[model samples]
Target: MAAVETKALNGVKLKKKEHRNAYATMMYMGTPRDYEFYVATRVLIKSLVKLQVDADLVVIASLDVPLRWVRALEEEDGAKVVRVENINPYTGQQKRFKLTLNKLYAWSLVDYERVVMLDADNLFLQKTDVLFQCGQFCAVFINPCIFHTGLFVLQPSQEVFKDMIHSLETGKENPDGADQGFIGAYFPDLLDQPIFHPPLNGSNLDGQYRLPLGYQMDASYYYLRLRWRVPCGPNSVITFPGALWLKPWYWWSWPVLPLGIEWHETRRQTVGYAAEMPVVIIQSIIFLGIIVMTHVARPAISKLYYKNSDKTTSMMQTAIKFIEIWSILAAYVVPFAIIPRTIHPLVGWGLYFLGSIALSSVAINSFMLPAIQVFVPLIGIFGSLLVMAYPWYNNGVVRALAVFGYAFCYAPVAWGSVVKLLARLHVSVEREQFFPKLTESSPPSGVNKLC
Candidate 1:
């Protein structure tokens, strides 16, 4: 086990438990670049733990770990560190993906009946007492689950995990490559109304907008952020899911927190600054090129742009323009380099072959699904066995065997997709061939200009 990042948390929960069930996430890698996110989540979560909510809140991970190991603060007084030694990523194989699935496999052994899984950034304001009241799987999330990772609850029954793994294997033969497709497959009933921030009162600030912006999906992946443009007052107690997981060099000035919201800034100093660098000094600048307001830095900078009437709005507009440009540029790049051979076989035969097998796998299982008592754990066992098997393979001779199995399983429907990828990647481009079927009628007026 590794050290728990105050930011990431995971687990499933159900309603009606005397004490809340929980799990904290810890990543194995520790790089210096992770500092900003570190400081942000630390200040945020520490506040919640400090609240001393009732029940034994155990911070499970690395019993006694040292990061830079500042001797004076080497140990925290109240936080308890623990390491889980029995976890495995892949159950039945020696491969990495298998190891990954191995850990999620632990859900089968959880002690609690009702479990509420939340991300670490989810700071509970009022005791989430109502969470334990519901009977089915429910989530209390800030509206829009785009990039949100916290506040979802589930009643783990092993069957859900099993179906997810099966879906993962099915996707390997389809468009998606793994079980993530199956994550919420069995829990569709719980997907309708996740818990939220704004209570839809219809008259509140920003008038019923939710918090966090983690709901938008990008191609095959889920993006980060839960709410945007949400308005909030000062000193408000709300846990923060990651708002901008994209890189800073993206040029666009995306929202750090919501626009009108006064997010509490942590008091800690940022990572680095050099005294000799002029950009490092901000407190002294006034206006124009001068450090004092004589020509440079009033309010912030009035004299330099004093005569420009639209300066304030220009700054804001410029910021918005960069974001729009970045978004446009990002659209052109291949977000995912899908394997050249696709799964839909009309364009190619391999995918159809594989997809046929996948359909059969499901068809065989469907007969069981109609009978709940048998299908539930059967899905779990079925999925877990796949993870242990580590069936997916790479592109070598061994991988070729896996691919053959993959093609045999899904190619009937997916071969066309594979052919499209090959054509796009390897075929030569001719102007007419690339731009076929173009007939442009010259428009007479501005009204005829259609985008």
Candidate 2:
């Protein structure tokens, strides 16, 4: 135990001997969208190579990360990729942050004498090799005396990793619901350590294990200046501490902080900007065509039907009404087409379901249009009853209950549609953009009225 402690403590200093050290980061690409982390991690490695850092660069990534990305890290960037099984135990309100447990696994890489762990969102501005010499569990102060886990140095050991797992298994609560909170609790006095370093070539150790404040500059501080504080750089790395959405890869973020340009340039070189965006463009085009056809073609056809019909005037009017209603309902599917790639799965499915319902309703209305005005209310009531009661008769109680419960949920939508239909019945049609009103008295310009 004494020797273990001594070795662990000795690993922290910039001793005059060759030591196995690594600049490490953990990435969890659990979903397709998480591929952004792969891009960001690649940028970090690019920065390391560009600066000619001496230590080994290592990535501890989730097993789900694509093999090609792992290969790129190893072959292109010359970094070591350590794939690990992601065991997520946090299941509280902050379930999203549960993946931070993957980051804690870095302490289990017992091969490295000392490891400097960084978050994937960090951008290296200057060579941060000096962090390698820092003491065990050294980190920058987030608040007055609280350590920020975005960038930190520590001795890797099986014992620490086991203890972390044990703590979690034993129900040790982490207020932050992530690695930073667990770490802050584990090493409460981490702030007492020496500050990482002073500005290039400034001074020596002050016996404190803390790193210099500049090593992990609060990116939010760059924008808000909450305390009216300027960046105390020459910063070694800039850590994006808040929302991942604020990261530099997003083009819209350019106006707020041009730092994203640096990240974008790095990405363009490594992965290139030609990504899944083109698919979104194709989808946008398809939806645009649908919108144009709905506005132009459907109305024209409806107007023709209204003009040509002799004894079936009511039937023609119903067809025209169906076209107008169906076109407006179909427009719901268009908004999602703009950024199809980024939309949530549930939301995308919702729009799809809505358009399908609208199309089906149009089909039914076209067949029963002249009679629909009489049966609309009955159809809704009987439809609700059949949906709920059929499941109950078959002894599928859960399905029946779900059907019954969801019926009331649609009351608002049904009421709104009823109101809208009534209003449309009372008002005369116009030759406007969406609701084109073509009356016998006043038809479209240069076009005869449908008599």
Candidate 3:
């Protein structure tokens, strides 16, 4: 115990024993799949080292992490690995949450006097070791004014760990099914306190410290910083939270996201960079093809159908038809491609459906009734499916069978729609030819034909 204290004392003398600081993170895959945790951790440690952080680096990983990753963390990154058993705090109602409950183990890392616990997805832009001086439980505010758990300062204690476990076992439910909710419940008054840090708090330098807003920036903020001139220059760390798809490591995010560049920088240093522009180009081409098919191709085909109809095409009619087609394209493209950046995706979709219904009402009422609406749509559906399925056929016999099957389904529907449209046109022509004469013909009102 004396020897242990001596080592602890030496660590303290190096950076102030009571002020010993470390950056820690937690990882638990829960299920087997490709994840960005290892790569993100490597990048994070590298960033800290680059910034010359005067602190120990630690990662509390669940034992489920592969042996190779454990070695990478210890041997390659020079991080202390604290392996713990995975536990599921959520059982009955929220069993699937599996909300990295193992993170609570960070509180038990008593070796370090103060630790800045970070989410695996956090990337440091500059030195944040100054955060070690902050008081316990400092975190930046996210939505609804709650301090985000993504990056926070906390003092480690076995007592706090035992208390948290006690709360968990005693059915003290965490509404968010994660450490954030539980920690928030424990430190509800943290928001009310005046935090030190004159740049962040503007007044307090002697009291507690609140996390600066810039430190836990979401990657989306980078876009705002670019376009709208939002401040991002002073930020020390950036946190990638919300959804898995939003992470920078994914290949699809490379084109527009700034974090993609950061991720690539880390990869180039740690794992040697591979040229992914070809892959990105191919993906972009495929995505563009889908957009063209849905917007430009579908609308152009509908316009051709209208033009080929056996009716006198007037200038007004042509203009209306163009408007109708443009509306369809707008309905398909605007909400998905444009509006989601400004507002919620669900709201965008609502606007899309509403606009589509309003714009298509005239077209639907004019032809859909007599044109066999159900059959026309069925023909379109099967035709598209057949076209998509055509490239997959390898065998001649199977290809022939599929072609026959598609023809069998589509021919009748097409024929029915054409026949119905022609009959309706014929009826209209007959009515136009006779209606004027009937109106012009005078009947003898005085003479009773019945008599």
Candidate 4:
């Protein structure tokens, strides 16, 4: 009987250890950013696993999140996925963040003693297992007064979860109507709490405490020193809380936010970009075919251009000019539309540049235009992207102002390019080379007959 009792006690202890803690993030569907966040979340989970943190990885995903994504999270990335219904306490909230309240489901995970809830934007630099030892609630105060919810520690409790749901139903006063605002209101006193310092003996603490800024180092801090210098606690994680478009997962965000490269490096080591490579390769092949065809068939294309001496010549010129302008616009827009939305930033930009060049070739070859004159729009676009992504701006307002300033300066240059192209088109029309010269023996073609 004594031996049996001891065995039973050991089994109970094992069960408790199995569910001691978890590092969790939430996912939902609706926005175009869904796939991007999925990729980011996978990287975050894999990074934690790479650190070999002493916790289970969990993803609190909404029902709308695709089944394949959930399976990948569980099988490929080694995370436990819990499907939940999306909570929308703030119906009037913007559609982008409408489902973010699903994060509240973290409190419902009573199987775990503690959970370190994270945003997918987090870049883990080191093991953060010590966060589990924090109290009932702990969060980094990245802002001077308000704690950021991007990375926070919480003890799972069904009672607390129920109370939160009730508060949401009761219409709690949430300034932003998203999880951050709601959670902030829920734990109003976190601002005044003492900073958490894990017990040396590995025992857990109980009440709310503030986590040091080191745990949630804002990426903007690196812009100042180009390195981290949070002297208080372990600089374990980095969070991007600024403009949504500048998130590290985006290819364009790198070099601008140099930290983005680090995120992609982690992704490369883990996920390996297998999903989007085929599409990229196929796109490259098609664009190459387009370039080759346009160049090889330039003579045939030139033959189709005909000189018009009648009054309709003005209308023909107007139509040709419209086509020229539209072609230029499409050259820029089509690449962005066709590329896979969730592709790695580097590949996405590469494909965009290639597509632009190939499409521009058609216009350049068809019109017999100067190559440099035709590519001015592409150069201007590249310049605009650089101006918008300049990272050293002190604030968003300054960034906006800088972009506006660039547009103000470049408007005249763009106009000059258009003017030059039109003048060249007029010269080509008069020369009769682009508009093929009609010999007296040649019969009128269908276009000429119609005119």
> Model 3 off-target regions past 4 Å?
1-19, 32-34, 92-99, 198-232, 254-256, 273-451
Clashes of 4: 1
Tens digit of lDDT per residue, candidate 3, span 46-151?
A: 7776677888888777667888888977788877777666656565434324646676777777778778888777777666565665555566667545777777
lDDT of each residue in 98-206, candidate 1, tens digit only: 2222233324324444444433344333344323333434433344432223444344456655544444444423212212222334343443443344332222555
Q: Model 1, 177: alpha-carbon shift in Å?
A: 6.9
- 10 residues in a row with least lDDT, candidate 2: 220-229
Per-residue C-alpha lDDT of model 4 across residues 259-331, encoded as one tens digit per residue: 6667888889999788888999999999999999997887666556654452346667667767877887788
The TM-score, computed over Cα atoms with residue i paired to residue i, of candidate 1 is: 0.35
Query: lDDT at 75 for candidate 1?
Result: 40
Best by TM-score: 4
**Estimated TM-score for each candidate:** 0.35, 0.57, 0.51, 0.76
